[model samples]
Target: MTRVLLIGALLAAVFWVFSIVDCALQPPIRHRGVSKPVWIIIVVVFPVVGGILWFAVGRARASALAARRAPDDDPEFLDRLGSTSDQDERIRRLEEELALLDAEDDDPRWRRPVPPPAASQSTAPGDPADKPADRPGDGDDDARDQRGAAGA
Candidate 1:
């Protein structure tokens, strides 16, 4: 009976230590409008009862609060799921069907010949006008031009 009592005491001490450390690491529970520090004091001052109370009530409340604050779903996770190859295949098939339906509709702009670049432009002849402008002084021209304009 004495040995059993000693073992029980040792087990209780271990449980108390575990509970205290776990509670300290976690954000404190707010129970019935009482703050976490009060709960921590109660647990530390009255180990067995405090530890049991924390496990039963405090931890649950804190967990619930954290869950409520957490974001609903991960954007990257949803993106990966939504953009899977199966979805891409479905989109491709729909686009092909649309193309077939629109084949009879002639839009001249889609088949029009591209205009040639101006002679003064040193860019490749086939390049579009919207392509980046080629300039001899691309690196320092803007600053020099600004200073020149200011001086004038």
Candidate 2:
């Protein structure tokens, strides 16, 4: 009886140490009602009863709650979701097309011809009529020439 009690006491001490260490190391498993420190204190103080209570009620419940809340950790589920390679391939194709268009547009031979200056347009900046009209799409062919003259 004495030996049995001593062994049980030793086992309880070992279990208590393990429970405390586990509680310290693991991120506190959150649940709806009870907080983590309360559970830790219960486990640490009560030893065998606390450890049993924690494993049976608190720990199991917390783990089940976490599993239900977040299922993305499952590798099989992720595998079934399909790869992003197709998206990458589509983006690459678009980038290649853009590059081709840029190369074609940048080539001097494919460039649009610059329009010749209008006959009535004066290149002088000081001319009252040469002041740029605010109206949109007004034929102001000499604007660039006047700016160039002013800069020089």
Worst 10 residues of 2 by lDDT: 143-152
User: Model 2, 1-152: lDDT tens per residue?
Assistant: 99999999999999988877765655665422356787788888899888877666666444365354244877777778657997788889999999998877777788898899878865677876775654433344333544223323
Q: Give TM-scores for every candidate, taking all chains together and pairing residue i with residue i.
A: 0.40, 0.43
Q: Give model 2's TM-score versus the native structure.
A: 0.43
lDDT of 1 by residue, 54-79 (tens): 77867756435543332337555565
Q: Rate residue 88 of model 2 by lDDT.
A: 88
**Distance (Å) between predicted and true CA of 149, model 1?**
18
Candidate 2, which segments miss by more than 4 Å at Cα? 29-33, 60-143, 147-151
Clashing pairs in 2: none
Task: Give the local distance difference test score of model 1.
Answer: 0.70
